[model samples]
Target chain A: MEIVIVSLLNGLVYGMLLFMLASGLTLIFSMMGVLNFAHASVWMLGAYFAYEVSRFIGFLPALIIAPLLCAAVGAAIEVWGLRRVHHNGHVAELLFTFGLVFIIQRSVQMIWGMLPMPYRVPAALDFPLFTIYGANFPAYRGFMLFISALMLLAIWLMLKKTRIGLIIQGALTHPNMVSSLGHNVPLVFTTVFAGGCGLAGLAGVIGGNYLVTESSMADAMGPIVFVVVVFGGLGSLGGCFIASILMGMIQTFAVVIDASIGDVLKPIGIALSSETLLGEILTVPMARIGPLLPYLLMVFILLFRPRGLMGTRDT
Target chain B: MSTTLRAGAMPAPRSSLVGPIFRIFLIFALCMALPWLFYNYTTGRHSGFMLTMFSQMGMMAIFALSYNMLMGQAGLLSFGHAVFFGLGGYFCIHLLTAAGGGSLPVPLEILPLIAGLCSMLVAIVFGYMATRQRATAFAMITMGIGELVATAAVMFHAFFGGEGGVSSDRMIDRSLFGLTYSQGVQVYYLIVAWSFISILAMLYLTTTPLGRMANACRDNYERAQFMGYDPKFVRFIQFALSGLFAGIAGGLSAITYEIVTFDSVSGALSANALLMVFIGGTNAFGGPILGAVLITLMQSGVSLISNSWLVYVGVLFIGMVTFAPAGLAGLIAMHSPLQQAGRLKPLIVPYIRIVVPGLVTLIGFVGVVELLSFKTIGAAQGKKLVLFGNPIDATTAQPWLIVTGMFLLGGLWLWREGRWFHTLWEAMMADLKPKKGAAQ
Candidate 1:
């Protein structure tokens, strides 16, 4: 029971982190019709920036300033890089970003070296925030939760209240109508691109410390974020949120359940050995197959629901 | 729309046999002769570098052409193409090892065929799932499937041999001739022969009824359906055939390297396929061939000189995507319009003007990149800044001033020269208009 509670909590936190990354990707993909292959690289940049800034000042200021810097970089990429390739097509745009991934990854290695940085949680948030079922939840996790919630509220409020946000909302559904109505669609694209990159940077700021500030962290986290966006469906933040939590729960819970399908089958009057492929597949423990869950979910979703669970657009 | 974009203009419908037949013989002679020329002249005994590079070119030639069958001819952008290539290699290695163990009595000459068949089977299963969707969804699904196989290759110890991978002996006793396949040159010949065969087969495929239908489906699936054809089926078959050729390439790789790893089937190689196809120019049948050769050359040559090879490739790819989607072949073919009108002489001065400034700009840009890389990366690694065989300090202001000055002046000059080049090109195009109209 304690394990279940702890896993749920961990899952929620991880899901929120996944949400932070996936939200930006989904927003950019839906509005622009181009999947930014360098989105995770931008997330990685956030972590590196925060680490650098934190060394000079503190984590607090780093968190605030790192995303702004990311925004600036994103603006340049959109205005100078993506705008030039805009005439070609979406495939060209995707390829351009794909190229950016290699450049960013190599550049990151060149700048930071191949070693992981020593970015850590602040001393103030290092202790336990509370005890839940004999488990101590760290204050840093509480802080992460607070920040994500604040971001969620902020995004929701902005979309509901602001003129630009309303325009973005309109573009999300009826891009042609929005364009025909005399709104500067290109400007919107640049703004959205920058804003999305800023969100990714924000994710990197916290996620880097929570995980590890390493060059390899981007590659590791990139696919999972993609899986989340695909599973949640594009053009639906609510769906993205739900998918993120579900995936997080599935991953965390899968790691704990060590019993194999053989054990489960033994109780149901079926005796199966690990001699055959099916039996072997069934015999593998849940813990061993934990990493495969997200991919399995993605394939299943793609085969059944091409548009995803709540997606208004097809991938 | 998809099918028509590729098949609307099929070059010329008359006298195809005479023209292609002559070209094929010429290509065949060139393919057979280049190796001997290189063997006698360049890097012949230079620590097996040239031999290895030649063999890589052969395998990549086959690989890139197969990739073009999808992107260029069929308009299917796959991100997991290396799956077949890698699997074919693994299967070949396993067969070779088994042959060495005396259990399998198969001859070494037919090893690639067996591998190709196996890969084709695998492609049939995977392609069924991948070809169901089109465009972005298709690319993403292939990515997912690719990651799945890559993960499994590491996890399952049954056939994959885990992280260590599997190795095989290549000097098999089973050969068509009485010669022992021990020397690197012998393997090179084998690769050359197979590459030629695969190229011929793929080219023949492009001229077939299925190939035409595949082009139709690529350009306009609706029109294909109206003509009583299934787009999905055409894609599936084409995908399977592509896998067959890719399998042959992988088999050659296995023969050359004598080992197969998960890296063979990784996303990086798949990206290489995309890069080779896109950068070589997908509009031409020989685009990926050019891309494969140039990329292989760059892989061998540029990588030896600089560590920032990926940055160069990335920049090139993005530049190609933005400015020249048709790739190197398109840039070359851009002159065809001028050639047909007999007005090529007028553009000579304009070309020279651009080339001079272009060279200057390249030198300046390359200098800045090398200097920055040296300061940040080389310094930490205790490597000296070496350019033109001379050691220099990167922190010096004189070098920085020269670099900036050259870059700024060259850039400005190039811009002005570019305007002139454009004006000349536009005038040339205008001059050719009357001729084109008269011919039509």
Candidate 2:
């Protein structure tokens, strides 16, 4: 019971982190049909920037500045790089960003060096917030929950009440109609792209300190972000949120459980040896399978529903 | 759409003369003579690098060409092509290890075929599911399938060997003519022969009804449907055949490296295939060959010189996408008429001026990148800082100034030369006369 509750809390934090990344990716993907491969890289940059800023100025200010920096870079990439490639085709745009991933990753290594940075939880939120059944909940996690909830509320209010948000929703569903309405579709694209990147940067700011701030964090988190976006469906924040939480839960729960096929088959007298392949597979702990869960879900979702969980179109 | 531009015209005598058979022979002759040419002229005693590079290029050439079949001919861009390639490689390694353990009698030369067939079998299963939709849906499904297989590759130890991967010896006891195949050059020759055969086979496939149908489907699926063909079925077969070719390449990789790992099916490799195929030019059958060779050469060579090679590649890929979407082949092909009309001589000076500045810019770019990367990654690791074979401090004003100066000067020179180059090219294209009634 204790384990389950702890896992739930951990999963929620993870899910919120995923949501922060995926929401931006989803918005950009929805508004502009180019899947930004460098979105995760930007997130990584945010983390590294936050680490640096936090070292000099403190954590709260670092969080604000890092995401702003990310937004500026994102807007520049949109105006200078992607806009030029857009005329060619979607594949070209995708490839252009694909190239950006390598550049950003290498650039991060160049700036931050190979080793993980010494990013720590802020002193104010360093202690335990509470304990449930002897499993202590860290204040940093509470902070994360607060931030994510705040972001969710802000995104919701903006989308429902703001002109840019309404325009984005319209563009998401009817791109042609939006263009025909004489709105500068390109300007909207740049704004959404920059905003999405800002969100990713914000996610990175929290995630980097929560997990170790490292050069490889982008690469490690990249596939999971893709999984979340794809599983949730492009252009659907609601779906993105749901998929993020589900993936988060699946990953967290998978690690704590130790059951395998052999465990299930124990009563049926299926004795196994380490030398045999099947036996080896059945003997491996579920904890090690944690890395495989998100990918597995992605494959399952893609094979069964290419458009994603709640995708309106076949993206 | 421009009346001033002489495109959609008769392709000219140069295209006719360079015909399929002639090109094929030329490629084969070059493949054969390359090793000896390098052994004689270039750096001596490092023939190992040459053969290794040669084999790697041949394998990647097949991979890229197969990718072009789908993206270029069939117009379906797949993001997860490494699935088939990796699958083929895994199976090939399994077969090689199995043979090493004495369960088969087939020679090493025939092993790639078995790998191809296995890849085809897997492709058939996956392609059926993937081909149900087109465009974005197809891409997503393939991505999903790729992730699934990659995950499985790390999970299943029997075939995939988990994370450690599978390894085997090429020197199995069985031989057709008692060739042990121990030497790298021998392996190179084997790769060349297989590459030639596979390329020719792929080219031949393109000329067939199935290939034509695939193109037709790509151009306009609605029109293809009206013509009594199922577009999905055409795509399925094309996907499967492409898988067969890609698998052959993977088989060669397995045989050459004597090992297979999850990296074989990694997203990086998949992206590499896309880059090679697209950069080479997807408009022509031979485009991927050019792309594969150029890209592989850059990857292996440039990586040694600069850590920011990925940045260079990113810049090049973006440039190609924006300015030359038709690719390097298309750019080359656009010049055929000028040569045929004997009007190429006037453009030589402009070409050289452009090329020289471009090379300078590239060199400067490489230098700056190397300097920065070396300062960051290399300096931290305590690696030597050698410039012109002498140690030079990176923090010194001289090196920094030199790199900075080169970047600024080279970039300015290249920009100035680019205007002249474009003017010359546009003038040449405008001067050509288009023949009446040719397909656009």
C-alpha positional error of residue A52 in candidate 1 after TM-score superposition, expressed in Å: 1.4
Please give the DockQ score of every candidate, comma-separated. 0.55, 0.55
Q: Candidate 1's residue-wise lDDT over B1-440, tens digit each?
A: 44542464355343565676678678777766665665555544523787788889889999999998988898888888899899999999999998878898987878988999999999999888878877777777778877787776776556776688888898879887755778777788788889888988887788876688888988898898887677887888899999999999999899899999999988889999998888999987778888998888888888887777777788788889887988999998998987877878877888899999988887777677677777767787888877657776788788777777788899999999888788878887887888888998
Tell me the tens digit of each residue's lDDT in model 2 across A27-72: 9988789889899999999999998899999999987999999999
Worst 10 residues of 2 chain B by lDDT: B1-10
| Runs off by more than 4 Å, candidate 1 | A262-284, B1-21, B38-47
lDDT of 1 by residue, A115-156 (tens): 799999989889999999888999999899899889989989
Provide the global lDDT of candidate 2 against the true structure: 0.85
Q: What is the interface RMSD of each candidate, in Å?
A: 2.4, 2.5
Clashing pairs in 1: B1-B219, B2-B218, B2-B219, B2-B220, B3-B218, B3-B219, B3-B220, B4-B219, B4-B220
Question: lDDT per residue, candidate 2, B327-353, as tens digits?
Answer: 899989988888877888898888888
Off by over 4 Å in 2: A265-284, B1-18, B40-46, B387-391, B433-440
